[model samples]
Target: MAEKHFKYVIVGGGVAAGYAAREFSKLGVNPGELAIISKESVAPYERPALSKGYLFPEGSARLPGFHVCVGSGGERLLPEWYTDKGISLILSTEIVKADLASKTLTSAADETFKYETLIIATGSTVFKLSDFGVEGADAKNIFYLREIDDADKLVEAIKEKRNGKAVVVGGGYIGLELSAALRINNFDVSMVFPEPWCMPRLFTAGIAAFYEDFYTNKGVNIIKGTVASGFGTNANGEVTDVKLKDGRVLDADIVVVGVGAKPLTTLFKGQLEEDKGGIKTDSSFKTSIPDVYAVGDVATFPLKLYNDIRRVEHVDHARKSAEQAVKAIIASEQGQSIEEYDYLPYFYSRAFDLSWQFYGDNVGDCIIFGDCSPASATHKFGAYWVKDGKVVGAFLESGSPEENQAIAKVARVQPPAGSLDQLLNEGLAFASKI
Candidate 1:
């Protein structure tokens, strides 16, 4: 028998879909009115902790779903949220295809769901160079840690190869955090960078250079100005070396390609119009296909600062975009005009020896705080007060012990020139003025 048509159908089980379901329920959308189909058996939870818990020592595995604020602890869960709302959870299923003409979605189990509105929060996957045919991968142990399985593989390798050596190929958040985790697991870690400094796309040289020394001091073999071409394996068919672009190599038991992630919209297969190969959506989060909307890493929605250039594969983007998608869906249902998603973008990572954060408008003109030290063997701590004349855009960190209260001024918007230094003398109350 065919299930009743839902007022709305949301695909994907990540934060975007979860947030949407919560809002739909809050708006008094009938308990039985919504159908949320998710691929993850587990409800939406934190994504960063995947690497953290997987890398935990034998006795340090964190209690799952437990949370504490100040001193209180409990699990903030979705099953209860879903139950109270009468949200049908079709878990462990995939929405294989949909008929835009017929307005129906066929699931893997051959179950069918028709909807008045649809959301495509399918998210994205890590981009592997094999898809691009880039050479360098041989019998080496190359890893791309994105999903739970990928992190599980890393954990297994860590248990078997404690004190082993691993090379991290990218300098992005995932790469940095994974490398740090490996080190904490007692693995010898060598971090290779595509740029002279760290997080070049996100930080000023001042802040990037600081982290260079910090990681090195924390037992990370820093390799800047080097590019990994591929990986090499030994006679046992395991990675033993990382082949470099200029014919050099780094000894390795595992090669982690933190190269970055791309939208998982590949399977969308032209069913949705794309901008730069990612599904495109308007401010309302509506895609070119009627009743279908996209969010999370799969979306190339407008960045009010980046001249509307859409980007993929960032956690901040996922959380904020998901929230925006829920708002847009609710507004539309109430016959209200949809508002575009615009906000100060933020993201962060907890790696070995430091907790780092990036907040605010990153691109555009800006002034920097701290010094861009010369790259050599000696390391220094650095911070960047990246800013445009009009507003402060970013705060770049280099494992500094400073209170960093100054960065808060720029967090809302850029502080004034010399304003940071003045705050160093003043305090958090100092206005970040132009």
Candidate 2:
């Protein structure tokens, strides 16, 4: 087998790997000392755009436009950036076997690489209907958006099936964003989920109500309390319809599934300590194995704010955790100490003209406030989650820059809420006062 060696190796070229590379550059990286291995042909770009701007019927986002760090208001790191920094990017190379004992990774092509330190940011894989034994789930034109190739396939389908009937499976961020994208492209879009409301994991019924009504107004159908049980295909094996658990069938020229994601931890399952289906790591993102760190969706680290261990799949956390892990690695190498990671959970989604931001733990009693009416001019609305008489979480839609920051502060501080009614009445003002 061909052999190579590096001081550091990042095993995934996604948001986390990109940010970690940037951090290493900032801290100082010697040429030929660092390398990134990825199965993708291109360097890391904004994955979220695959469902949003990349699907736009016009002027869609493309590579170099939404590269890593750009989402966080930092400079875009193009492939040339890696070349300029002398950081090797081994794209389109899948490391099939990893031997932690020898700190070696073997790619499918029989190429072997040895690393002094390793950062596993393999990210998450999209859950598929086929995984659940749904018949006809592998039919053509049925796409799952996780990588650029998947997004490219979906875009091609959108163009080939213009004004076609599209069925979106799942009600989380992917379903909502893709439904909106299909609608904008003149496709008859319908969303299906096994919940009463969309984004059940984060949005309360009231928040979901606003979005569902808004989507309906935009001519997108919302089918809740049911799921796509199977699929129907034409003679050519292209998806033509979706069969729901409720014994209902809907015509579908194209299907998009985003039921959920599973962390890509199978390779290290027996080698690393895991929690909640992810590789367990400390605040420094150091895995159980020495010199092995895990970040992004694959790392379930401590959430200091909640005093709990959680794995955050959002891009914000992906970037922050990668930076933190790289920083920790640098500190350890220099025999210096750094502060433990203290993260406040954050999640957000955008579709059509609506955008919502949430911070802190979602646990506790929720109180909806502000003008959440769909017909409202400003379309401003928010919700607060109180736990043990303290405001532990906050969510706001159509909030201004300052307003969103204020709500995040309220979640971090978790001020004692005297009365639910009083807090509801105060609304955004409550966060502003804090």
Candidate 3:
């Protein structure tokens, strides 16, 4: 078996891995000291783009164009960048075994890699209907968007099934984005979800109503309060229809499922402490084991802002947590100290001409403000989550750059909302003043 060693190793080449590598480079590294092992052949690019700009009908984003850091307005680290920095890029290699005690990883190809320090950034895996034993879930033309390969397959399917019928099974971010993309590709799209409204976990009914109306106006069918129970397949094993639990059958040339995702921590099961189906970590992103850290979607770290241990599965957290983990690692080696990560949860999504930014905890009584009417020309609106008389969270659709920053600041500061009516009336101005 082949064997290798590195002083620092990062597992999983998603957004977190890419950012961690950048932070390591900034801290200073020696030749052959750092290695990144990933199941994907390509280095980390913006994963979120797979469902956004990557699906654009024209001028779509392509690799090397949307690599990590580029999404955050930083330098794009091409493959050559790894070589120049003397960092090993072990691509298309899946680590089947992780021995945290020995600091060794065994790849599927029987290669063993040892590291002095390890960063686990395996990210998350898309939830598949087949996992729940849904009939005909494995039929062809049924897709799930999570990785680049999945996006490529969807793009190919879109080209092959142009102007065909598509049934998206979920009303989450992926469903909303994919439905928009399918529509852009000239496909008749129908969205299905079991939730009462789209993005129910974060978006309030008032906020969701605006998006729902906008989607309806765009010729997309929204089916809620029910779910796809099964799929009908043709003789060629391609999906032709989606059978809903509510006794409805929708003709479909393609089906896309985006129910949710779970942290990809199966490889390290029983080897580390887990919380909320993710690896438990401290504020510094340090896992239970020494010399090992976890970040991104896989890390359930302490949320200092909310006084809770939370796992944020958003791109913003992925990037920021990765940087914090690397900084903590480098600082410890140099006998230095850094501040604990005090992150205010941030999440956003873009579909068609509408965009929204959210920050802080989305718990408590939500107060919707601004103009959310679908027919309104401005289409601008926002909501504030108040808890214990403080504005704990903020959400704004169609917010300007400065306004979004102000909302984020409001979430972090959690200013007192002396009067709900006054705050509602003030709206964006309340956050702006803070």
What Cα-based lDDT does every candidate model obtain?
0.67, 0.94, 0.93
State the lDDT of candidate 2 residue by residue for 269-322, as single tens digits: 799999998999999999999999999999999988778899899899999999
What ranking of all candidate models by lDDT puts the best one first?
2, 3, 1
Scored by Cα lDDT, where does model 2 land?
A: 0.94
User: lDDT tens string, model 1, 1-434?
Assistant: 47558878887876566666656665677877777787766665556676665577755443245211101122354466677778887788787877766778888888888988888777777777576665656454677876566766777777887788888888877677777788888889999877877778776665665667667767888777878876666678787888777777888877788776766674577577889768888866778886688887788777774456666566557666766776777777778876577755666666654565556666555444444343433222223343444344445444342434445446665555454455434332333332
lDDT value, candidate 1, whole model: 0.67
TM-score of 1: 0.83
In model 3, the worst 10-residue window by lDDT is 303-312
